[model samples]
Target: MSALFPALLTASNKQALRFDGRALTYAELAATAGSLAERIEGAGRVAVWATPTLETAVGVVAALLAGVPAVPLNPRTGERELAHILKDSTPTAILAAPTDQLPPALAELTRIEVVVAGAADPTPERTLPQTDPESPALIVYTSGTTGPPKGAVLPRRAIATTLDALADVWGWTADDVLVHALPLFHVHGLILGILGPLRRGGTVRHLGKFSVDGVTRELSSGATMLFGVPTMYHRIAESLDTDRELTKALAGARLLVSGSAALPVHDHRRITAATGRAVIERYGMTETLMNTSVRVDGDPRPGTVGVPLPGVELRLADDSDGIGEIQVRGPNLFSGYLNRPDATAAAFTEDGWFRTGDMASLDADGYVRIVGRKATDLIKSGGYKIGAGEIENALLDHPGVREAAVTGEPDADLGERVVAWVVPTDRQSPPSEEELANHVAAQLAPHKRPRTVHYLDTLPRNDMGKIMKRALKSA
Candidate 1:
C-alpha cells in the first residue's frame, strides 16, 4: 500500500551504507537508484550480479524502485546451477557493475552496467513508484537439494512484514548500526543484513570480506549489531580466549544474531562464557523469510530458536511428541515458485498451511528446536523417528570429536540404521567406534547410537558453514 523504504525519502544522513571502505548516504543512494529505475521502469524481471558490493545494493534498490522483481545471480554459481536459474527466471535485463564480467551462462541475456551515484538528487520530490504490495519483489532460488532449484517468488508485503517484525523483536532502530560480511546472493545477506537496516533508516558497515580484525574493528568502533552465520561465530568463539579485542568488541555490542544454519550449543556456551553475551538464533527458509527467533529480551536459550513472530501461526502437523514437520501461515510467506504451479501447490497443505519440510519440536514455552530437514536429517530407525541433529550435537559434546554428521542407511533388520560420520580432533588418537557409540547411547537412546561409524579428515560444508548432509551420504 505504501513505500517499502520510506526512510530513503526522509532521511538526510550520509552514512546509509559503508561497503568496501566506500560510503553512500541515504540521499546519494536514493538518487542513484531513482535514476536507474527510470531507465528500466517497465521491464520484466531483471537479473542482478549479486556481488558483495555497493553497486549490487544499488542494483537491487533500482529494481525495487521500478517495481521490477529481480533474480539475484550468485557470482560463485556453477555453470549448471546458473543455467537453471537463467532458463527459469528468463529476466529481460542483467544488472551488474562495470567491473563484473558476465559468465557464459548469462550470455543469452541483455546486459546493463550498474552506475554508481552521479552528482546528487536533482529532484527529491519524485519518490519511489508505489507498486502493489502483493506484487513479486524477488525470485530467490532454493538450494537445489531435491532437484533443479525452484524460484520462490517473494512479495513486497513479505519483506515489509518480516523486517517490521524483526525490528520489534530486536529493539532495532535508526540509531543502531548493523555490521556483517555475508554474501549478497541469499536472503540472510540481501534482505536481513542490507534491507533490514535501510528500512529502519540505519547505517550498515559490510566488510567486503569477513575477518576477525574486521569484526573487532566494526563492533568495537561504532557498529551496534553483528549478523553472521554459524561458521563465523564458531571462529569468533574459538579465538575469544586468545583475542582480547574481539571478546571486548562482542561484549560491548547491543545485539549478536546467527541464522542461515543452526549454531552449535558448544559454540554458544563458549561465546557466552567469553563475552557474557549470548548469540541469538533464528529459524527460517527460502520460502519463509523468518518464522521464529530468540527475542532480544527473552531468555538466551542455548539451543532453541524462540517463539514465532507476530503474524506467523505455526503448528506441528500430526506430531504428538511436540515434533513434526513445521507448518506455517503468515503474510511473510512467499507467493509461489515462479512458473512451477504444480510444485507450488504441493508445497502447501489442503487447509492452506505451507509445509516447511523442516522437522522441529516446540518446548513447553513455545521455543522451537529444529531437529533437521525432513529429507536428510530425519532418521527413521527401528520404529523411532530420530533427529540426526541431537546425535550430532551429543557427538560434538565429546572432546575427541571435531565434526560430525548423522544419516540413515538401509538396514534389512531395522528398516533403517543410524550411521555416524565423524572427524576427530586428533586422527592418530581417534576415539574408538565403541567409545563414540557409547557416548551417544548414554546421552540419547542406545537404539539411536551409530550402527556404523565413518571417519574423515573434514566434513563437507557449504559456504554458510552448513554440513552438506547429502554430500556426506554420497561420500
Candidate 2:
C-alpha cells in the first residue's frame, strides 16, 4: 500500500509492451524508470509534454518514484495555457524533449531546468525514492468550460484503489493486451489505458495519436482491447466503408470501451453491426478516475452507463423527482481541486459525498443511467423539464444525420425552446427541419420535440469529446 509502483513491478514481470515494432518487457520498464528517477530533483513538480510513447510513460512513473509530482500537459496546448500552468504550479524543472515545438515563453523560463529523456541519461547522479500512499502523484488539468482550468490533485492511494477496482470489475489480467488511443494528458488514458494494464502484468500498445488508420493498423497487429471516447468510435465506424479490413480488424478485437462522453445510440448500433462487438461505455470524470462501467459479460444497454464498480458508493441527493444529482464516495476520489479551497468545499456535501453535478438514476436492477448534466444540458420549457440526451438520441436514429447536439434556446413564448444543431452525413440529403421535428415527436413527448433545428457541417467539441454546449447556446 505504501509504494504502488513497486507492488505493480513485483506483480508484473516479463510482460511485453509493443511499441514502434519493439517489445519491452516489464523488467526493462522498471529498470529504465528506476534509472531516470535518479536524475530529477526530489519532491518537486515536473511538467511533461510529449506524445504517448514508451519514453513518456517511463518518465511519468520515474518522477513519481522520486516522490515528485508529475503534471501532464496536452501536446496541443497553447503558449498561454502553458504559461498559466507554469506560473501556478512553479515546477522545479520541465521534463520535455529538446525541440523547438515548445512555446516561446517556456524557452524564457531559464530558472527552471529542462531534462530531455528517451536518450542516454548524461546526468546519472539522481536516485529514486519510496512513495507513501498519501503522497501526491499526479496533477491533471480540467477543461475550463465554466472558467479557468484548474489542476486536480490525485494521491497514490487513489490511483491504486482505482486500478484495483477496475481490475476487479473488468476481470483484467496479465493476459489482456490494452490498445490505447486517447491522449495521455487525460486521467482516463493515464489510468485505464497505461497504468491499469501495467499493474496487472498486461501489455499496453500506445497508438501515439488517435487516428482511424493508426487504430485499424494496431488492431490488425493483434491488439485485443480498445479504450476510446465516443467520437473516436463514431469516426472509426464512419471510415469503415473506405477500409473493409479496418472493419474486419475491429471485429477481431476482444473488447471495445467508450467513455468521456455519452455514446450515441446510433453509433452504438453501427459499431455492433460492423464489428459484432458491443461497445462497453463507462462513466468517470477528472475528479474521480472511474466510478461505474457497463458490464462486459452482462446485457450491454445502449443508453445506460451500467453499475458502480467495486468499493464505490453512488446515491442521489434528493429522490423527489426520481432523478437527482449523482453523489459518489470512495477511496478513489481525488484529494481536491488545487489551490481553490472554496471551490473544493462546494464540490462536496456535508456527509462527505462528492457532488458530481450530473443528474442520474439507478434502475431497480441497480443499473445507473446518466440523464444529463445538471447545469447545462437540462432544458426547462413551459414548466416541463427535457433531457437533451433523449432528443439527441432520437436525432441520431436518422440515417442522414451523422452527429447531433441538443440545447435550450431562449424563447419569448416558452421559458426555453428545444433547439438541435445537427451535422449531416450528406449535406444535400440533410433532413428538413419539419422532418427532424416530426422524427423526435414520434419518439419523445410533445414538449421534448425540437422546435428549432439547425444544420451544421461540424459541431465544436472539447478535447474530451464532450460537445461545447456553451458555444451552441451563444449560436
Which lDDT tens digits does candidate 2 get at residues 117-201?
Answer: 3333333333356677878889888877667788889998889898888777677777788886777788888777887777777
Off by over 4 Å in 2: 6-16, 41-43, 108-127, 241-243
Candidate 2, residue 25: lDDT:
62
Among these predicted structures, which one has the highest TM-score?
Answer: 1
Q: What is the lDDT of residue 451 in candidate 1?
A: 92
Candidate 1, residues 1-475, lDDT tens digits: the string is: 1287878886475588889788888888888887888877888999999999998998998899899999998888899989889899989889999999888778778888888974567566654568999999989998886689999999999999999999989999999999999988899999999999989989999998999899999999999999999889988988998999999999999999999888888899999999999999988888999999889999979778899998999999867555699999999999999899999999999999999988988888899998988888888888888888889889989999977889999999898999999999899998999999999999998998999999999988887778898898899
Instruction: Provide the global lDDT of candidate 1 against the true structure.
Output: 0.89
- In candidate 2, residue 277 scores what lDDT? 83
Best by lDDT: 1
Q: lDDT of each prediction vs. the true structure? A: 0.89, 0.78
TM-score of each: 0.97, 0.92
